[model samples]
Target: MKKTRYYPFERNRYFYGKLLTVRDFESEQKYFNDKRRLMNRLLHGTGVITGLQVIAVDDKSVSVEMGAAIDALGREIIIPSPVTLKLSMMQGFSNNEYAKNVYLCLAYDEKGKEPVHSVANAAVRSDEISEYNRMLESYKLFIREEAPDPSVFPIESIIEQTSVLYQDGHIRILQRTPRYVNPGQLFDVTFVIEKTLQAAKISFEFELVGQQLQAEHDAKVTFNEPQERQETEYEVTVKLRADSSSRGKATVGIRQDHAVLRIGDKQVSLSSARANEVMIMAGAVDKQWVDDFVNRSLEDSLDSPSDPCIYLARISLLQMGPTYMIEKVDQVPFNEYVYNASALHKLKSKDSSAPATPFSGSITARSSLRKIAGNQEPELNVTFNKDKGELNFDLGLPEVQSGDQVRTGVVEIPIASLNKFAASPFGRGGKSYVSAEIEHGLGRGSLFIYTGIEEINEDYISDILSSSERLYSGSTDVFKGSEHEPSGPDVKIGTVLYPQKGTFRIGVRLQQPTEATQINIRWWAFKKATESGAGSDDTVDISSLEAASGREEQA
Candidate 1:
């Protein structure tokens, strides 16, 4: 099989007076064969196009299933039937000095090596023999260590076969992973091979679309929370695998400039055959998608068709403020209200912003209050009703908002300080009322109103009084501010004990506020809680309070 030689013009030209020699016939045959093979190689590029699976029939033999393929030299190879070969009987095994792999290929044999006429030429006598054969080139299988090229003695050339170690029982990816994955996110995938094979030899590839991390550096393997490791080889075998399995625990890790980002554990057990819930940490894989997607979603979802758009549009166009809530709870229920109604259902708070704030009642309201400017504070006129035993409070401002200047305020009035008036001489007569003035101005706001007076002996400040949170105004100064938060009482609000401080603050959004805006606050007088009353602290006017005489008391 010395390299078949030919020139572009070497093709024989047959005419009425041309010599018809064997060499001329052979050269013409070579030209067409080479041309066809070139098209097969260039158009189809080599390898098994379909159905060339190699299944292990035994420890010493393998079965190559029927298939069609193209070879390196552009030959059409069609295995009409499954072919089985004994590995030890292969010619390459005995002939080659070192047998690494045996390639079983399809080739064109013109020597009549395949069973047909058993000889190259059909000749009656040895002296009168013909060089040209009557039989066509036969397709046959050949086994060799290194496949033969055209220059070989008898070229056994065709497409390469599957590796003997990597056929049917060799490797298989058992799990289907998500098609699209973020670069650092953790994802689970399982691949398997026979028990005796070195697992690391097989390639377990992960795809990170568009982005490539430096190998052995940016990419990482993790069993759990990833930690930095100096060792380049990251592997830890978890016990429990099938008798035939190469499955075990391993880690994939990469170097993070900050820390080792790990892909979670790859664990397998035969009984379960399923890996442990061992988190396949896809850290960077998962992280990239999270950073890209988390914020892309809405903070809150709405059910209405236009609801998402409605909320988003309002915030963008109007520059609207977030909805806030305030709760005013009365110790005593209304005279006609259901007993212990609110106490029946005690729900836990999610401790986050809800899409729509529902009114949770023991007493609760969601409303907006202005962030006030401490300058030009509103005057609060607090008057106690002598007949009704009710106290009324009014903090008024004529023009709540104007051009540029702001008018926001924080006012704290202690309940115990107001106790200076003592019990009103007039008790329970006419009903005092509050006018709903700014009720319409409350856009997405709500108010909870509760009012009551509890009689306490003053001798005992019960558990309620000892362990409650008293409040005071938040900073009124918009720029130069007072303290905004209190010392304690996180879960508890507006609890009273001899009036350390009491809560009162008015807040409003300064984004082009109303020219004549009013806020209606349903009053909550906390003179009571868990069976106790309010009292304490402030300078008293001795001159305004005259000591009563026996005759003066009657008058």
Candidate 2:
């Protein structure tokens, strides 16, 4: 009725005259033992650390191999020798349920007696008063209707789980899984499972998507060979119970004696009376979980901290009245459970592929500086929506691997530079100039961003981004080509007076100056195009103005 927590090292100090009693010794032992228990629980979580194999002895019984395990309270239980047990006698057994699945659990217990200090060994009556009967720790084997949760049970180390169904045994399965992740990257794999049997057909399908990820295996293991029984085939569809701990990546393991006919599309494995023990683990680099399996043991399946206690295997039987027989046993290996996106993505439905996007496009133009050969504009792969004024452009960069996330260089459009080069129809102030840095290569129009396609995989995203874009135009001079005659450093195209139908010449007469001659030039253009004047690129007669001998001759 009372609960007491042991505070270690509170034992009494021995003095020369003080009497040492059995209680003192018991206290010392409890301290050390409690300390060890704490260490065990902290260091090793519950489950078989090594050497516990549950072998099927028959329909009603199974054998347990020697092993060691830590319970929830950190108690270490070591089975010194292999022992056989009957399943029907263990707790939670019943003949009533037609389909009964009972997990054989190994639990911890305490037994051997300690001293009854207050009374003699011979107490006349059955109910005898005593000081105490301390007990020695021991272990027990029991059965649970469902797998034990680590939170509620001191133990829950399972030797094996058995179903009382009548299996015709013709169906066997094997599965394989990827071993190690690429750390920062992932890879694709061609998954394959081999089968052996006469005239049997099988198909496989799986889906591991969203927050709740599980591999639902459906298989039709049938018997083509004629048999006395009425039912020749049975469907073994293993629907795993979902766990919140693991999401995208899933790893499953099984016991050594039981050859797991993989719970999936019709498939199977290695042909032997007894295939290799199911010790398939997930941990290799080329791929893990396999090559390391030989060196590993299913006996140690519960040792690792990274993975979980996964569903191993299950079997279904026909009608329970005892007329059918278990057929043949086939074994198969599981494909490794992958954690990286590269592999998990493959598990998606074929239709799950992403829609076409610009980022996925191939780079059509090389990164260059020279005038695009032949003055041909680079196919910017851009579409401008007139109604929305949105412009979409594809940079044409190559697709990147899942791990290679550096989408660094982008086709950038410098609006500032574009505005600077925006020119009017007439040239009066200066010439239009464009720099190659902002005008060449992928920068043709310079209108995009590049942070790597970490979120989406598209060569360009402008189809949506360009919808809100607007075009800017610079101011223009309406009188750029006036009709007045003018003289200037340069003339506008139409501002020059040219004869429409015939070639014409102009004559310029000048005086031979006695001093240095200077002629001033002007725009001569109130309206130069209409006022025909001595023009540039023109044929003209040249004559010098002669000095007059007297004013009368000049008149």
Best-fitting candidate, measured by TM-score?
2
Superposition error at 295 for model 1 (Å) = 44
Q: Would you list the C-alpha lDDT of every candidate in the order shown? A: 0.30, 0.34
lDDT of 2 at 327: 26
- TM-score (C-alpha, index-matched) for candidate 2: 0.31
What is the Cα-based TM-score of model 1?
0.27
TM-score of each: 0.27, 0.31
lDDT tens per residue, model 1, 195-264: 1121223332322111221121122222331122111122322111111222222322211222321223
Off by over 4 Å in 2: 1-12, 19-23, 113-134, 149-184, 187-319, 322-555
